[model samples]
Structures are given as C-alpha cells and as structure tokens.
Target: MDPLERLSSPAPEFLDRLAASTRALHWLVALPVLLLLLTGLTNFWPELKALHVGGARVFAWLHVLIGLGFAVALVPSVIAILMRRAARRDARELLAFGLDDYLWLQHRVLRAAGLRSVGPRVGKFNAGQKLNAVLSAAATAALMGTGVVLGVNYWSKDVFDVDLVGAVFRWHTVLSVLLLPLIAGHLYMALLNPGTRESLRGVTTGRVRRSWAERHHGAWADRVREERRAGEG
Candidate 1:
C-alpha cells in the first residue's frame, strides 16, 4: 500500500503532522527570501543612498547569514526530496506533467491578462511551478557562488584578485536582478490566486483542507487511495 493512499484517508493525527511539518518548512523558506529582498533594495537604490552604506553592509551580513541558513535548510529539503523520489521512483511528481498542466499554464497566463474564462486543472505541480523551482535553485546557486568570491576577497585579498572579486560582484548583482521578477511573480501567484492562496495556507498551518488536496493533487489523491486499499486488503 502506498503512503499517499494512506494520506488520502489520513487519520487526524497524520493530517496534523503533515500540516505542521509542511507549514514550518514553507515559512522557513519564505521569510529569509523576504528579508533578503528588503535589505537588498535598501542596499542598492540611489534614492535610498543615505541607507546604502550602512544598509548595504547590514544587508550583506544578513544575506550571508541567510545564505548559510538556506544551506542548512537544504539538508532537510534534500532528504525529503530523496525520500519522495524513492517513493515515486518513476512517477517523479515534481517533474510530472500532462495536458491539464499545460492548459492550466495557458489559462493562468490568459487570466492574468484578463483573457480567459476557466483555469486549467493541475496535478501535483503545474509547469509554472516546476519552472520557478528550477530557476530559483539556479539563481540561489549563482548568488551563493558570487557571495563566496566577494566574501573571500573582502576578508583576504591575497587569496584572489581585486579584478576577479569585482567581476563576481557584478555577476551576483545581475543574477539578483534577474531573480526579482520571478520572485514577484511567485508572490503574486501565491497571494492573489484564490486556489494558490488556499494552498499557501499549508505553509502557515501545516495542513491544507482535504478538498484543496483533491482539487490540486487529484492524481496524487487517487494514488493514495489505491495504496490505502491495497494496504488494508
């Protein structure tokens, strides 16, 4: 029997546990991103120049701290991903897709521009989410790489050249700018879309309504049911 099937017919305790774990991790990821953005802005804008020197220094320290935190968070995230991968071996839900997911993506775009009537049905993850995850991961790596170079240069110039450090800083800035729009889009989707907003409740509460799971993860729900029945019989 599959664990997901058991989840579909979740005991109250199981649901509670799932909700709490999911919510904790989601907020853990979100808070730092928000802080990093606020601090980064104060560090960058000229109109906010008065805050730049002090703000940038503070932000730089904070960013590095948050980056280290992210690295720590990745340990658990990676473990979860591995466990999920083992469970879903071939299904690969995170990378899964079908006609519905594509249509949903199209519907979202049209709706965003006030051109669509109905949204598309999505499975465990829509195409947009997959894209966002990939982009965010790449951007994070780039930011961390550039940060390391800059930090090394700042603390010990003899380890690397001034020119190289400058170049890395430029790369970090460019990647950060590229990440801004995607982050904004992610926030808007999470906050503005009714379905997404409800889904996001799981981030804070740790457990989403059963209906939300049925609607957004129908296939997963189906699998969970199958697994449970198999386990019972």
Candidate 2:
C-alpha cells in the first residue's frame, strides 16, 4: 500500500488551499494597487515624468483615483474577517508567528550564507512571510492615510496646512521607496524563487501539490490531512 494511503481512502495529490472568494478579492485589490504603484513611481521618476511633461496632473489624479478604489476594496476583506469564521481562521494563520517560525527563519538565513543549520518545521507561514504580510499591510494603510491628506490638500489647499502637507509628502515618498523592495521580494518568492514558487499555484488555482506542501509547510499540511480525515469520518 502507498504510504499516504489509509483505510478510509487513498491520499490526495492536490489539496485545496485558497478558496475561490479569497482569490477573487486578491485580484480585485491587486489591480488598483499595482496601478497606484506605477502611477505613483512614474511621477517621481524624472525621466519618466519628462515624457509625460505637462501630463503630470493627469497621472497624479489617476494615482489618487486608484488609491481611493484600493481603500474601498480592502473594506470588504476586513468585514469578511470580522463576520466570517473561515476568514478569521485564515487571518490568524497568515499573521501567526512564534518560536517555530523564528527558528525556521534563522536556519534559512544561515543556509543562505553558506553556514550549516538544521531546518525547522513551520506552519502555513514562516516568520519572513508573516513579516512581509504585516509590513505590506502597514504600508498599504500608511499610504492610504497619507494619500488622503495629500489628495484633499491638492483639491483644496485650505483643507490642510502647507507644513502638514510637506510632512506627509516626505513620509509618503519614503514609504513608497521602502515598499518597492518588499514587493519585489514577494514577487520573486512567488514567481522566481525555486523553493517556494510552487506556492503560487495555491493562490491562483486553490490547490497545491501535496508533496510540496508536506515538505515546505508540513504543519499546515498535516492539519489539512487531519481535517480531511475528520470530515470523512
């Protein structure tokens, strides 16, 4: 008999991970967020800005529009987490970080630096991933807050003082610059990094190879197995 095979039923090769609604919300927020990044960055880039010379106002307005949409899009996800049990569980899983996650991160760093260290088992998310998620969310919230002030001031200078606008402007630029690397690393891990790139399938297709999950996210994979067996029982 196969190792994964049990008396109840044979093992599953692909396990359901992300739900369809989760994927839908991801795409909904992702599009406007990506556009905001593009428009926001282009406004700061001298060469890029020169191409659109007099059209700076247009891009700036576009950025503000997208920012508003992104803020609105996030509200539903937050509401779901508050109102739905499944979303709450997923939020907990995504945000959880403890000793195992820390140990896994330490070993990963040491291995990357060519030092020997035994890898530790981690749940659905490791420390680095949870950190990334937390930072990204923080960045999103910060940008939204600062962007709103800037947007309001732009439309009506009487709304906020020059000193306040100047302060938020500096902070907005700094946060935007800092967020780029985090976003790059996230994309690399999802699309380029050999080790965890397969996880992209879980987000996109709602399923991942059981073997890959067992190796990379053993704790979560075991929980999934147990849940499935319980349901069968």
lDDT of each: 0.65, 0.79
lDDT of 1 at 222: 60
As a TM-score, model 2 comes out at 0.87
- What does candidate 2's lDDT look like per residue over 107-177, in tens digits? 98999999999977767777887898788888878988898888787778998889989999999989988
Error of 2 at 183 (Å): 0.3
Q: Which stretches of candidate 2 lie over 4 Å from their true place?
A: 1-12, 50-56
TM-score to true structure, per model: 0.68, 0.87
Q: Per-residue CA lDDT of candidate 1, range 143-211, in tens?
A: 767766766665567998778888888898898899899899888877887657755655556556555
